[model samples]
Target: MELITNPQPLQWPTLLKRPIFDNAEIQQRVMPILQEVAKRGDEAIRHYTQLFDKVTLNAFQVSEEEMAEAQRLVPETLQQAIAQAKRNIELFHTAQYDAEKQIETMPDVICWRKSVGIEKVGLYIPGGTAPLFSTVLMLGVPAQIAGCQEIILCTPADQYGKVNPAILFTAHLVGIQKIYKIGGAQAIAAMAYGTATIPKVHKIFGPGNQYVTAAKQLVSQTGTAIDMPAGPSEVLIIADHTANAKFVAADLLSQAEHGTDSQVILLTTHAPLANAVNAEIARQLETLPRKSIAEKALENSKIIVLPDTETAMAMSNVYAPEHLILAVEDPDALGEKVINAGSVFLGHYTPESAGDYASGTNHTLPTNGYAKAYSGVSLDSFVRKITFQHISKQGLKNIGLTISTMAEAEQLRAHAAAVYVRLEE
Candidate 1:
């Protein structure tokens, strides 16, 4: 990791820029795949699945037999672990449910909003270098809670033409039956524009590689709703003299291992602590299985020695990391200063992995400075709030002039006439 000391605020933007691919190029490459899927349907899916995943499948949907086999293959201990995680995710998301409350603007005008689940939604789980089984709980639990009519999942099959057993097992645990053996941009296209076998969805969720991210963005333009614009996973840690070097090193490496493009940052007031954490990262990097990947990510990562906590916090807000860890002496006080972040880990004990797995928070978050605007996925992501209003004759008499006058001021005669007609009735 590069170490810089007391850089000016003018240099911060250039210093903190994420390694991002050219959007035009990515979108250019992803467009043809989407067009083919829309033009040819399941045949196109089969072709791309072979081209990208190197797996040829006769059928796209996972059968009851495959699901049963996956259940048998998953160990009891792992199944229990998944169950526990599911319960935690369910509890956290279930609490987000809001009861409808009617508000009266005037004499008899009653208005309220009700959340309705998107009837059909698709979840894309990446099964390439890592099979994110934990994501199944993060997305599936909320979709179920939101009462989505149909939930379809798409994941790539391995060279052996089989979906990951853990992925299948977790999907079954969450009551999702429509599983497809598809991957990459093809999977996004299939969900966005329905193929013969895979049904089109009202909205799509989950995270993936650059191609998958671009595919989601491309499809969204044509009217399919996507969860959010996402990129490589990232984390920013604000450490102090009281912070543990070992713990900080571990936290940084955890995100670094996500992908070669994933970046981790450390902002600290203590220069000695930065050196200690750097040494710890080098020591710990040797044992990791994804050591090569993390090493490449570290080339883009940084450890900057700032003047104080206030400067560090301001820098972090500009970066707006997907995950922010406050490894300070008084985390509670520092945490209050956080205005932008997808998810926050409050102390040394609160590692980002806890929220990624069983802590009941959704791990599907915005990346590449998007945390400044976007929020991580939650129960609300799966549902749309529809508002309804009821107005009595007396209520129309009271509010009609206000509406008509505003409509006339805006020069929308039709809108004013509509209100006048109601009042006349």
Candidate 2:
């Protein structure tokens, strides 16, 4: 990892820039796939599946027999673990359900909001390099809890035209029936515009590579809703002398191993601690199976020595990392100032993996500094809040004059006429 000492505030933006590809080339590559899927439908989906995933499939849907086989293939212990994580996710998301409450804004004008589940939603689980079965739980549990009518899932199949057993197992666990063996930008397109087989969704959810992210952004521009602009994984660790060097190094490598585009950074107050963490990272890299991938990611990462933990925390807000780990002593104190992170892991013992797997929090979070604006997936992501209001005669009497004055001032005659006509009646 590159080392820097007390970088200027002006330099922070350049320092915190995420590893991204040339936007023009990425869009150029992605648009044709989306167009093909839009025009050719399932045939296009199959073509791209063969082209990108190197897998050919006569059928895209995972059958009940396949699901049963997957259930049997997955170890009982892992099944039990998935069940436990499902329960925790269900427990956390269930609490987010909104209760209807009527409020009187005026004398007799009553207003209330109701949460309605999006009729159809899509979930994309990444299957390359690593099969993110955990993502099925993260997105599926909430969709179930939110009572979304239909939850369609798309994941890439292997060369044998079979998905990872664990992914199928988790999908079954969460009661997701429509699982597609399609992946990447084509999958996003299928979900955005319904194909002969894959259903078009009101909103799409999940994390994927830059192509998938760009596809979501493109579809959203044309009025299809998406969860967030979540792309590659990233994590920021703020450590002090009191933080565990070994644990910090391991955490950094954990995210770095996600993909070649993944990023990890360490902000420390002590130079020795930074150096020690670097040394520990070197030692730990030897044991990681994805060391080659992690090594390339580390080329884009850095370890910076700040004047103090406060400065580090401030810098962290500017970066707005998808995952932020405060490994310093009394992380709670520093966390009070944290305003921009997607998810925060506090203290030495808490690892970001907990939330990614079984801890109650949602693993589908904002990335690419989007935490500055967008939010992670939750029960709310699957539902839309529609507000309702009723105005009684007394209510109109109380506010009619103000409404007429405003509408007339704005020269909207029809708007004022509607109110006046009602008052006259």
Candidate 3:
């Protein structure tokens, strides 16, 4: 990791930029896959599955038999672990479920907003070097809690024409039956545009590589709702003299191993702490199984030495990392200063992995500086709040003139006329 001593605020933008493909090139690559799936349906999906995943599949949908086999293949201990994670996820998300309450904004206007689940939603789980079974829990548990009618999942099949047993087992545990062995931009296309077998969904959720992120953005432009412009995983740590170098190094490497493009940044008040953490990272990386990938990511990562805690917090806000860890003595005090971040991990013991897995917070988060405007996926992401209002005669009489006057000022005659008619009646 590169260590910089007090970079100016203006230089931070260039330093904080995520490693990504050129916008034109990413669009160019993803558009054809989306168009082909929209045109040829399941045939296009199968073709890409073979081309990208190197696996031939007669059917894209995982059958009952495959699900049963996956259950048998998954170890009992893992199943129990998944179940425990499910309960925690369920508890956290279910609390977000709210009861509807009608309120009177005006004298006789009764208005209430009710959250209705997105009827058909699709979840894309990346199936590559590591099959993210945890993601199924993160996305699926909330979809179920939100009462989505159809929850379709798309994951790539391995070389042997098999989806990971853990993935299959998690989906089953969450009651997601419509599993499709599709991957990459093609999987996004299959969900966005209804194919022969893969049904079109109202919104798409989950994190993926650049291709998947680009596909989601492209499809969203055409009217399909997406969770967020979430892509590669990332994390930023604000550590002080009290912070543990070993823990900080482990935290940074955890996200670095996610992908070569993944970026990890460290902001510290103590100058020597940067060197200590780097030494620990070097020591830890030698033993990590994904050392090659982590090493590649570290090439883009940085350890920035700031003057103090205030500057560190300010820099963190500008960077807007997907995950922010406050490994400081007064984490709560520092966390209060956080204006932008997808998820936050407080203290040395609270690693970002806690939120990613068993801690119940959704791991499907915005990346590449999107945390400034977007939030990580939650129960609310699965549902739309539809508002209903009933106006009495007195209510119309009270507000009708105001509405008519405003409409007349805007020169919208029809809008004014509608209110006038209601008042007259």
What TM-score, computed on C-alpha atoms, does each candidate reach?
A: 0.97, 0.97, 0.96
Q: Compose the digit string of candidate 2's lDDT tens values, residues 1-425.
A: 99999999999999988889976789889999999999999999999999999988999999999999999999999999999998898899999999999999888889999999999999999987899999999999999888899999999899999999999999998999999998999999999999999988999999999999899888898879999988889999999889988999999998999999999999999789888889999999999999999999999999999999899999999999999999988899999999899999999999999999998899999999999998899988999999999999889988888899999999998999989999999
Q: Output the lDDT of residue 7, model 2.
A: 97
Candidate 3 stretches greater than 4 Å from native: 408-425
Q: Which stretches of candidate 1 lie over 4 Å from their true place?
A: 410-414, 417-425
Q: Could you tell me the lDDT of residue 299 within candidate 3?
A: 93
In angstroms, how far off is 369's CA in candidate 3?
Answer: 0.3
Off by over 4 Å in 2: none
Q: Give the alpha carbon lDDT tens digit for every residue of 261-305 in model 1.
A: 899999999999989999999999999999999999999999999
List the RMSD of every prediction in angstroms: 1.4, 1.3, 1.5
- Model 2 poorest 10 in a row by lDDT: 18-27
With a 3 Å backbone cut-off (N, CA, C), the pairs that clash in candidate 1 are none
TM-score of 2: 0.97
In terms of TM-score, how similar is model 3 to the real structure? Answer: 0.96
lDDT of each: 0.93, 0.93, 0.93
Pairs clashing in candidate 2? Answer: none
